[model samples]
Target: MTIADSPARYGALSRFFHWAIAALLVWQFGGICSEAILGEDHPLAARLSANHTQVGTILFVLIVCRVVWAILNRGRRPDHGPGLLGYAARLGHFSLYALMLAVPTAALLRAWGNERAFAPFGFPIFAPRSPDQVVQTATAIGSNFHGEMAWIMGVLILGHVAMAILHQVAWRDGTLKRMT
Candidate 1:
């Protein structure tokens, strides 16, 4: 109920950011996975893909906000604890944050460098580049790495969930409770 995080547990805003981002990421992945598995023309896949760009844009904005909020609440949040397990936990979290930012950024860069206008949510984000002015480097990096990095991020997310479950069930620790 509190607005700011405490040593014992995350505050309302942090929890909101955490859960909202999780849900949005799930949605984004679902869209891509559906298209990858079912083919783009399939009804379900098509429906999900229809909103992919718009949803990604919204998710990207939310991520930036969440990172800023996390920085603002750094020391007040729950601790990872001492020794090796703690170090692993910290590293895992850092990886997650890095990918969360990187995946969308690469995609956005591609959009920006593409020949077509980049309009997510019907708002013009990037104007179409003229043929001679296209940024091949941005396009190439985005095209080459976005999907690969996303899959890596997906694996990391699964590991993150597994660890949370381990903490809640095996360790019988209050770690999962800190966010929940």
Candidate 2:
């Protein structure tokens, strides 16, 4: 069941998902940044890539939980910001959810398409098909779209962070407080 009223504060599950996602994003950003600076051949780059994959898998699961939670608790309003700002916030959030779902789904398809073994915890989610047609098609589509989406996500995320900083520093708004 979901709460229809405005939340007094984020519930325990909401808070956990929010903070967990935040931490994972931080780790992801760090890994991405390090990879850009250190080059792909560096030891740190390899480690970061492994870390990125593991954390991304966790993010995929967390996002699924978050979406389910959000669907169930549809009526609870978040703390309000300025009118235009609120619209932007909503847009940003929607974009975030779209990218979160799309990116991972694409990556999974790409992996499966290549007939690559996905041994997350030593369990295979999909069995190998002798002729992997769906995976092959998905991998081609996913590679192109995923790169484009990644760029879009990066811009939106930067904007989101900028807005949060603006709220905290310039406006002294409580926008960041709700999530923080």
Write the residue-wise lDDT of candidate 2 on 57-164 in tens digits: 899899999888877776675755569877778878889889978877887777677666665766787666556355668779778786577667778888888988
Instruction: Estimate, for each residue in 44-87, the C-alpha lDDT of model 1 and write its tens digit.
Output: 99988788888888888988988999899999989999999999
TM-score of each: 0.97, 0.85
**Candidate closest to the true structure, highest lDDT:** 1
Per candidate, the number of residue pairs that clash is 0, 1
User: Candidate 2, residue 166: CA error in Å?
Assistant: 1.0
Which 10 consecutive residues of model 1 have the lowest summed lDDT?
A: 48-57
Clashes in model 2: which pairs?
Answer: 113-135
Off by over 4 Å in 1: none
